[model samples]
Target: MEKYLEIIKNSYSSYWNYLKNSVFMELNWENYFYGLIIISLIVWGLEAIFPWRKNQSLFRKDFWLDTFYMFFNFFLLNLIVLIALSNSASELFNDVLGIVGLSIKNFQLLEINKLPFFTRIFIFFIVVDFVQWWTHRLLHRVEFLWNFHKVHHSVKQMGFAAHLRYHWMEPVVYNSLKYIPLAIIGGFSAKDIAFVHFFNITIGHLNHANINWDYGGLKYIFNNPKMHIWHHSRELPKERKYGVNFGITLSIWDYIFKTNYIPHSGRDIELGFEGDENFPKGFIQQEMYPLGRKD
Candidate 1:
């Protein structure tokens, strides 16, 4: 009994220390909160001034629900799942690669840290974005995955916060596969990762915001709100087998894959999946929705 008690005590102590060091010690809550606030203000301001759907209110349908989704996804789900999965996957891959006598250190395709700062960011951005694009296409193609991804498509009104309105399992799917190529290309510095993250956040916001800007010919390179709006269209275009415009950052992938579809104007476009009106509206219900419940 004494030995068992000692073991339990040590386990608890180790867990507590890990929680303290890994979470509290590294987490910069101030920066996170301040950054969120600043970005929200800027995006919200842009949406209000240069509105897409005219006369649309800020407090449109499902606005608060999307806000809840944004917080839940970023703060709770992503923080836990991404950190755990990434660390575990890294360790697993390292061990597996070591057994084959090819380690990331020796067999790395690109020494990203050795590159210039902007170049490193560009490379990381393109690589990660390609991964996201592929994962997003998978989410739409696979029926089981679509059930979870439907939570995102159920939105009738698109706002800045709507970008993060996705099922909790989404980050698990995306982040798990995203880092593999990066790992093969060599490890990135913390700064490079941050740079890519910043661009992702900005682009994600703009893509989902209630703004109408295509960036003209640049739309073929970078995904704009107009391009992404079609992605949420209820009816798939005649030419596409699955959904079109699967790109997250770059539309080049969609064009190459022949999934690109952009109408002259998105003004008449009605968003949301078919029969989504029957879907739940509250955050909790939406979270529970992908479980195949009739309710």
Candidate 2:
């Protein structure tokens, strides 16, 4: 029995090393796609089974739109990564703002073997959430930024795809803007970077979920579905609650900013903008609206 256990451990160790070396090659498009599909399926399955709102339609008109934007969003992100790889404007931007003086790519060691899986994930979440919370709040206070970000707020309700509704430029600029500081701080590796994206995409869905779920006392610490619901409130009184619950992982920033609001009720809250009555519903319209309007 002891011999069998030793053999199992040796085999597992060898297999783990092989997996790390294989992934160290150029981006495995197959595995990349696999990771994306896995994330989407898990999120979609959760929505179907433990839906925030029981009667919510999983396939609504906005649902399709959200899905479309998800693909588009990813396309744009990959394009940026590509450009950053090449010596283009995107790379230039990354250079000027990157952690090091002019290095665009910060391929830190993908430390898959050094730690337990959960420990690595926990560290990544903490680092990524801190950066995201501040950047999200900055978008609210800065009027120019609010324009790009408003596309996200323009949504009337949260759907599975609702996480995709954002002005393309908003994320591009925001990503570059935040990553610069993160790179400088310089603790995150490639795996940590992947975890950042995984958490963002996953939590963004929860933020827009129709379910009236909350993390109970946990909302005071973490940004749950309900706290995010208020952030999208259409009522002026509620919209003012923006910037609280800034940390995607933890609501610590919101508590610090006094932006955290624990509601008395549940999913009955109205969503969307309070003043932007003429805001269009379509993606093209939302993109072009700010151009013609004074608001």
lDDT of 1: 0.78
Looking at model 1, report the run of 10 residues with the lowest lDDT sum: 25-34
Q: Quote the positional error of residue 204 for candidate 2 in Å.
A: 2.4
| Structure candidate 1, residue pairs in collision | none
Assess candidate 2 and give its TM-score to the true structure.
0.72
**lDDT (10s digit) by residue, model 1, range 1-295:** 4544454555555444544554444545324444555687798899889988877788777888888777777666634455555565676777788998977787677877788888888888888999999999999988888888999999788788889899988888898787678777866786677667767777888888888687788989988899998899988755564688998888899999888888668756789887887988888788888886543
User: Which candidate has the highest TM-score of all?
Assistant: 1
| lDDT, candidate 2, 156-183, per-residue tens | 6566577777776666565666565445
TM-scores vs. true structure, each candidate? 0.86, 0.72
Model 1: CA > 4 A from native: 1-30, 293-295
Query: How does candidate 1 fare on TM-score?
Result: 0.86
